[model samples]
Target: MGITKTLNDDLIANRSEVSIAEFEASRRLGAREGVGGAASWAVWGNENDDLTIFEDSAAISPRLRKDVVLIGANFGLGGDTGEFPPFKNFHARKSGGDSKLRKAITGTALEGAFLTDIVKDYPTKDAKGLPTEIKSGTLDTNRYVLSGFKTEQEALGLSRDTLYIPMGDTTRILWDLLVDRGVIPAEQRVFHRAYGNGPLFKERPVTYLRHYAGAVDMVQAVQGLLAQLNLR
Candidate 1:
């Protein structure tokens, strides 16, 4: 079925996750320390480009594993053409790819999965400026961003077994960089972006999809991803 607004609404209603209001309150408190600070990153919300890292309201036992982690490239907060600009929390306005992503994960193992971006506060319309940001030293992937990512992972209680789904090539590249830097183990960079059966891809811990804003059959793509991750 094609993604619909009602699907997004129903999905939002059904999930017992942290609310935007509560998260915004947390963000406000964190912002006093600094935007994108270690504490803010650890919170289940976006620090800069309003993304939602929905944590279930019910307290999770420390021993229980969070099965999935969905990673995006960065917050695309710039551009006048944005359909749903962030309000208080970056993901407060769920339109375009945000809504598409939420809808696609419905009924799948990824439902209620923790969502975040590798690069925080680097707001652009897309990944076009990522290379520039990194090369110019304005964005520190290792010392800054990676640390925040680790903090978030630790806060979420994510383990190596957590199935990571980086949203696009940009995210995939960053994910690989993290793997190389020893932030993430090399073995965890399991599947190629194309995702096919081959000796090179005979492992687990990571899989990916096209960016939600790009041309993609969201439903079919996620269904295929579920099979790839054995979440079927």
Candidate 2:
């Protein structure tokens, strides 16, 4: 097949190449090199406390299939280079003061279209040491920590035709722009429900595209996805 009829348009628009030296520097720690049965709709979420969802949607596209892998690195918090702060600061925090800081940080990071978080309910401690319910809003500054891997998985689900690749802690957003533009068949938009076996081959039918951990993984996964579909 020519570039896999099912490939997404966003994945086609942003494919590129890089040096081997760059590739080695981007691999993630503890990322194993084994393939298994692909879950058609695996959604990643941070701990229950930080339940951010990652998936393919018009709002959060997973720019599937490309040669270049995108990855994210942490520069620190409250600065231009770090990952976004918790959703409370980015979205729900009151206006002005730290709000400006959060906006500045988010705007800079999201300039190229990266996915982040939104505020949610979390647990808190009361004066008597009893567990209390606290909205993400009331946390003191610095209480919000960047989310982790499981959280990333909870937000996004991968199946036969779709995969969730993380660019840093943020899931690289992807949309079915092909469907939006009416380029691909409407029935091919598999993200709305579970992916079917029609997209798979052999036992290891689903292929996950990834690269070096952190920022590089995102680029590598996109590249891998493109290469795979192009061969189809």
Please give the distance, in angstroms, between residue 2's alpha carbon in candidate 2 and its true position after superposition.
Answer: 8.5
* Number of the top TM-score candidate: 1
Q: Write the per-residue lDDT of candidate 1 for residues 1-232, one digit (tens) a residue.
A: 9533322243234333434443444333323211242122212223223444324323322212244456676655542312332222224354566556656765654564555566654456667567566657667666446665555555454556555667777878877765765656665523353344412112432256667778776776665555552221
TM-score of each: 0.60, 0.23
Task: Output the lDDT of residue 6, model 1.
Answer: 25
Model 2: residue 58 alpha-carbon error in angstroms = 22
Cα lDDT of model 1 overall? 0.49
- Residue 126 of model 2 has an lDDT of 18
For residues 1-232, write the lDDT of model 2, one tens digit per residue.
Answer: 5444333444444333223332222122112111010111111223322314322233222322213212221211232212232222223233232233222222221122222221112122111111111123243211221122223222332122332232222222221322343322344323222222323432333343221222333333333333333222
Query: How many pairs of residues collide in model 1?
Result: 2
> Model 2: how far is 82 from its true place, Å?
12
Best by lDDT: 1
